[model samples]
Target chain A: MRRIISILLLGIIALGITLSLAKIPFGTPKTKVGRYYIDKGVEETGATNIVTSVVVNYRAFDTLGEVTVLFIAAIGLGAVLTTGRRKKPERKIEPASLVLYTGCRFLFPLILLFGAYIFVHGHLTPGGGFQGGAIVASAFVLTYLGCRERRISERGSKLAESLGGLIFVIVGLVGLAVGGYFLMNFLPKGIPNFLFSAGIIPILYIVIGVKVGSELAGIIDNLIEESE
Target chain B: MSFLNHYIYYIGAFGLIFIGLYIVLVKHNLIKVIIGLSIMETGVNLFLISIGYIKGGTAPIFSTPEIEAARMVDPVPQALVLTAIVIGVAVLALALSLAIRLYQHYGTLNLRKIKEQRW
Candidate 1:
């Protein structure tokens, strides 16, 4: 009876959300922001993608907030997982079959390079901080899962995450220090369609990607260690 | 694409979201609840991706001659969905680990009995 009641209540809530979504409109009204995109974002940002414009420039503070959420989640996971009374012995993992291990070894550098490419080119392309960061994290995940017998270097991962996070803060601070606004494009806009023109945006994205990758690695490491 | 043209799929997707929520709310098993949450998330991502798809639109990859890049499906949502899927995995892993810890304490996966940690 209790379970049934809970289901009924959930159904009602779901119906309410559905109705709300049905009524709420998407595709924002073409207004000042839309015009701004047409006027400046196309080339000045050197990005072929408008979404990158919105993320990197028009509302960069929001991206900072999003990265912070991931950071907080990583910290929270660390806190929660460490709370148990008994620390389970990190168990032995069997050496992966030669086929799988060799394959991942071949793929790891390629994936990391791809992630770095995405991060640095965020200003000139569709990929940006979050996307690139997640990609880097994914590479780490594949390495952790496939190379089970190997130990993840905790110190390196921690340094990567912390430095990534610190760089983000410093990037924003440069905006505040140089001008009043937070996350202002600190560098002078160079010739349109060039890599150097986007200023701190590309660098910031690289930092975000590294941070995300390492934080995700930490989460996986803790989970696997505990589960063993 | 069928996803762009079909009104029925939208309804079905909404229905899936609804059912998933219902399961998540009522299920005693923690894994089932997580599954329910994941299904709901997939439905949301599907809806987001579908909105960007145009009728007869080709994939975002620019290798095709028949379809121009401008007319292809918007790549923005596809990119966002990729990020969202990773976030979902992170969330799911954290949730499952917490569930494991809870099981250790209570010796069962039932939510109702795990009231010791509840506010």
Candidate 2:
């Protein structure tokens, strides 16, 4: 009986959707060109990846806003997790398992390199600052778990995150001053599809990656420590 | 309201979100509230994934040689969902830990009795 009811409900839903789609106008109908951006975004933005153009150039302000939110969240976290006097908590994690230690020894460098690559090449690929940054953060988490004794220092985390955020905003402002627009692509467009090409996009992605990675690491650290 | 019909999946998803929100609001049971929060998050993730889905899209993985990239589902939302899932897990773990601490402090799960932190 339930199966029948579920099927009937699904059928009704399908019918409703079909009817509604008939009414809605989905962008430029029947225009293949309309499905994609009008101009070649890669050339216009000097970024190899179209997605990068959308994030770093088209919606640069939104990315900035996101980074600021992260910064605020980190500050809030630090405040909440703050305990008795000692500015930097000296609480230490234990030594990790041999397997984790050994495995991490092998994977950590590769992961870090890959993360940097992602951030560097974000302007020419599907990934971006957010994604790459998060990946790098996970790498820190791996190290934290593996070599528990040397879990990232709170001070270090804060410095890296805040500095990265400060650098990013400074870069954006520089663009506005130089190009008469915020996050303006300032440098030579470089070779169309190279890693060092897309002027400010690559640099911005790296900055974002650093900020995000540090913030996440700190948040995780606080949560784990608080739980214990 | 008419938009709901075209977005049937999202309509149901939104309904789940409200239902979950209500659960969180009304229920005193911490576990139940956590479950509600999870359900709400699932609704959001579902809506996002559905928004990225094409009418006749197939799996994004390129297992076959003649894989048509356009026909393949956009993997971006799925990628975002994966991050959401990780965040959800972290949040859940933290919530559960807090619940445990609450249990320790109050000697009971009744939220009414644990108003020490209430502003």
Candidate 3:
């Protein structure tokens, strides 16, 4: 009976959504602003990657809000899980196989390096801070899975998260002071297609990378500890 | 055939969305519901990305000088989706954590069996 009702409800909703979606033709250029970004993004942001420019330059305030949202979620997870917890006896965890443990230990630093590469080259490449940060977090997750006995330092992750958030806000405030607008591109935008180019963009992205990386690792830590 | 070609992406995206909705509405397990939510998020992300597609467009990045501005897809939606995807991850983790609390408190994973969650 429940399945029947849900299917009926979903069918109606899907019909409505599809009917509305049909009017918007697929595979067509839309949004005038998108065109503007494509034409002038390189010159304005000094970043060859237009998506990075849009994320870190054009709509930076929105990104800040998004980062805040992520932070709140991480905090909330910690709060929800830690509150009123009855201490259950620790469950014995079998050690991971030697092969698996050695592999994770070997690959962990390499994964961190790759994530750093992604965020640092965000202005000139396809990836940016968020993707890079997630990659970094995955490195932590890999460690958790392979090295069951090892616990991440909660204090260190929190410190990195706080520092990253501080730097982002500080940079924005500096822009506001110098350029009279929050998150303004106050620094010199060097030649495009270079690592050192795009001024505050790479700086902000690196900050975001660290922030997201630590926040996610913290969330994973909370969950893992709770499960254990 | 032409009609199918034009609407395939939409159909696929909406199909996933509907499937996720079904799981969320009908599934009894809290973890399954969270998984359903994640699936729905993936579907919505797909829909958003499809909205920015052009028939013969390349990515918005100018990795090479030869790539033309006129031939690139919309950057705005891609940027929005990037943030959305990360936010989705955060939400999923949070939801899973809540599920863990629910299981711990109730000692079972079933929605029907949990006294507080009974409909």
RMSD of each: 4.4, 7.4, 1.6
Q: For candidate 2, lDDT tens digit of each residue in B34-104? A: 99999989987986677666666665432334655466444445545644554565456557656766776
Candidate 3: tens digits of C-alpha lDDT, residues A22-137: 79989998899999998989999899999999999999999999999999999999998886758778789999999999999999999999999999999998998999999999
TM-score of 1: 0.80
* Every model's DockQ: 0.27, 0.11, 0.89
Q: Alpha-carbon error at A11 in model 3, in Å?
A: 1.7
For A155-174, candidate 1 gives per-residue lDDT tens digits of 99989988987888888888
Q: Give per-residue CA lDDT, model 2, range A1-228, as digits (tens).
A: 543554566557556754654443321123343124223555667775545665666667867776676666556555555556755556655677889899997888888888888877777656666777778878888877786665688889889887887887788789899989877888778876677787888888888778777777777787677554
Candidate 1: the clashing residue pairs are A133-A209
Model 1 CA deviation exceeding 4 Å by range: A3-7, A18-20, A23-35, A83-92, B1-9, B46-89, B112-119
Residues B13-94 of candidate 1: C-alpha lDDT, one tens digit per residue: 6777877888777777888999999999988887776666665765543222343444455555665675566667777877
Q: Score residue B83 of candidate 1 by CA lDDT.
A: 57
- TM-score of each predicted structure versus truth: 0.80, 0.69, 0.96
Q: Is candidate 2 or candidate 3 better by TM-score?
A: 3
Find the 10 residues in a row with the least total lDDT in model 3 chain B: B97-106
Chain A TM-score of model 3 comes to: 0.95
lDDT of 1 at A48: 49
List per-model TM-scores for chain B. Answer: 0.85, 0.86, 0.96
User: Best candidate per lDDT, number?
Assistant: 3
